[model samples]
Target: MIKKLLLGLLALLLCATAYLLLWPVPIQAQVWVAPPAPGYVGPHAPNTRLAGLQMISLGAEEGPEHVAMGPDGWLYTAVGSGKLLRMKPDGSELAVWAQTGGRVLGFDFDAQGRMIAADAMRGLLAISPSGEVSLLTDHVGDSPILYADAVVVAQSGEMFFTDASTRFGAKALGSTFEASVLDILEQSSTGRVLAYNPATRQTRLMAQGLSFANGIALSSDQSQLFVAETGRYRVWRISTAATGLDVRQASPQAQVLLDNLPGYPDNLMRGLNGKIWMGLVKPRNPKIDNMAGKPWLRELTLRLPRSTWPVPKAYGHVVAFSEQGQILADLQDPSGAYPEATAVTETPERLYVHSLHAPALGWRPNDLK
Candidate 1:
């Protein structure tokens, strides 16, 4: 009986080894050199500024991942439920604005006062003030946008937005969060930026080859564009004039502004006083950095149980930077009372912070000095 059992155990071990080595995983991991993590220092030192966030109940809704001030003066946020929740800046009179039927990671008001949204599942959309949602463009030329992310509307009625990853479609992958994990692990850098012209009803590719392009904000004069590349932990500035361009290629019009951030950067929004705010959803995981060059290991990791995955712990952190790449503000809550800080919406009196999976909206008095 002992000999039989030993042979069975050996057979099981061999099968497990083969599965780990040769499983048909979703990602085709690419080898890359990860930048050394910059521990919280300099302008990114740890602080409790984001702690004690006054919570605003979303009732049964959760994950206010993107918050923005509507043209009509109410604060609006897109929840995981595909419902846009709107309320007073003080978190009162909460009401549903419009159900986009897709996850809107970012949105902005266009010249016509329409909400231009980058919906992860539905593609780019234009939502009228009266709550009617219309599809704008899901494909540019022969290629379809897989993950529509942050968007910024120009005064000329042109819309610039990010297609977060071409290989990982949010609709097919079950959720944006899950697709993002696969894309980042793959490191194929298929993310790109595109421009949509409402007049011509055409979408044009702007740039490409980003690991996971996330947030986007246009410069004051709308001459420059800032983008957050999440997996690489950096923000980039690309000129609006560049079309059909590869950001990976060195060019005067494109450059990295903030390099080697301490955490994974998410949404980017223009803030008060010429500042642009970015949130770090999770701190860097050393294990991930270590595996950056190990393509096979990443594939093997996928064969393991998800509970053994090296996902980092939650930490509330946000930073503000100038177009010149100067660190203007850094807020952190180490306790993570408010998790997955994705971005911030600033009003005169309240600083509304957005989270990816928090149960409610978080805010604090605009009392920062």
Candidate 2:
């Protein structure tokens, strides 16, 4: 009789376990639907005209995350594993500009040719052409910058960049790793954009209450700044002369540029063609977006290894959008370029791309021009 009772209990436990595994829990739903149609095609086939496409190899070990062109025509790239490299138009490497001892994300050259870098661990940095490095600001107001993602130079030489997250720094954080899962579950605003003045050598908070501000780009007229909020899957615009530093007052009323991107965008750049080029780090997963509304599920997912997690692959892609926010073209990894490209910068003679997983710059020279 005792054995029969034990069998019955085992059956009951198995049924309960099966029910728990199959039951659907109530979670917040945020669906990012695909665009009605993709605006552009992937990279051109090999031996083609190569007019509108080019890819260069930075020759780094891990991955090149961002790229910027200097006034001298040298292409500079930030390889995430603490290295910065310069390459010529023909894809020949020039020199190792500087070493940040941390992951370097975005880079831009100031009017004086000084390179301003956004380091994920070191905050904002200025590196002279001679390779002298200076630390600008580690924190804005009282909060430390957790993930300094991208930087842009204005005509006036003011430096602007995005602190992608306040809760998770870049070195330890991955796109698959969601900070909004924690923030939304806890209810707080930790993301922000910061500015540094060369004359004052001081860093100040330009705007706040951001939800994972990832990429930054200045308008063609230099009168407005556009920032990408990764978590919110939208971009917000701020006035170049916007008012008070108070979080609420400084908040620039955001305008949604592109909603429901097929993937999450990393960095943004204003191209010579007057269009915006955005890097889609990895395609968004419906399961993960659904988890954003549930704290417990998010916490569990965060604990999993990034490699073992059920996230999308980093298929490198560059999306070009018109000034009116229409996607004009889509460039893919035709040469099996970078496994995961995070940033892109267009020069007069070439298009520079930075990847996140492999240490190399992918370049496709302007054969047409």
Candidate 3:
């Protein structure tokens, strides 16, 4: 009986090994050396500024991934339910502005007052003030805009946005959260940045080969573009005139403005007095970074249940920086009262906090000096 039990145990171990090594997963693992994560200290020191913010409930619909102020002086935010909600600056009189029938991760207003959105599932869209939605451009040449993320409109009326990943489009992957995990695990760097001209109706690729090009913002002069590459934990500054440039190949015009950030940076918003506010979605996970050099290990990790994955814990964090990469203010909530604080929109009265999975929109007084 003992001998038989030993043989059965050996067979089980073999089967487990085979399942890990030969499982047919969606991600095609790629090798890239991840820089060592700098755990929160110094400028990114932990705090409780985000712990007890006032919240505006969204009822069942939640996850305000991005929020912006319209020229009408109302606050507009895109929720997970594909509904664009408009509310007063004080978070009252909530009403549906429009629905995209798909997720809109980020949006900005064009010169004509049309709200241009980077919809993850539907591609780029333009929504008029009267709630008429139009498909701007779904494809750049033969390649479709996979994950149309954060967008910014130029003074020249051009639109620039980030395609978070080519391999895991939201339409195919079903969920932005799932697709993001897969792309980050694979580290294939299939992300790209593109530009569109409304006049000529032409779309062009500006830069490519980023792990996950998430947030986008143009410079004060509209000469340079700032992008947050989430998977690599860095922010890049790319020139608006750049065309077909490969940022991964160290394009001179495309420079790394901030390197080795302590967390995965999410959205970017211009604040008062030449300041830019960025949210850090999650603090870095040391385990994930340690396995960066081991491609096989990362693949094996994916084979495990997603709940068992080494995703970093949700720590509410947001920071304000200047054009020269100077850290102005850093806010944190180690208790994570408001999860996935994706971005911050500043007004004279209050600073609204956007989240990825919170039941409410949080806000604190714009009292940061």
Encode model 2's per-residue lDDT on 22-101: one tens digit a residue. 44432222323323323223331222221234445555445767777777887777765588877676768667888988
Query: Each model's TM-score?
Result: 0.99, 0.77, 0.98
Best by lDDT: 1
> What is the C-alpha local distance difference test score of candidate 1?
0.93
Better of 1 and 2 by lDDT: 1
Per-residue error at 240 for model 1, in Å? 0.4
Best by TM-score: 1
lDDT of 3 by residue, 91-119 (tens): 88899999998999999999889999999
Any residue pairs clashing in model 3, and if so which? none
Write the candidate numbers in order of decreasing lDDT: 1, 3, 2
lDDT of 3: 0.91
Worst 10 residues of 1 by lDDT: 360-369
Q: Which pairs of residues collide in model 1? A: none
Candidate 1 to truth, TM: 0.99
- Clash number for each model: 0, 15, 0
Residue range 6-81, candidate 1, lDDT tens digits: 9999999999889889989999999999988989999998899999999999999999999999888888899999
RMSD for each of the candidates: 0.9, 5.6, 1.1
Misplaced by over 4 Å in model 1 are none
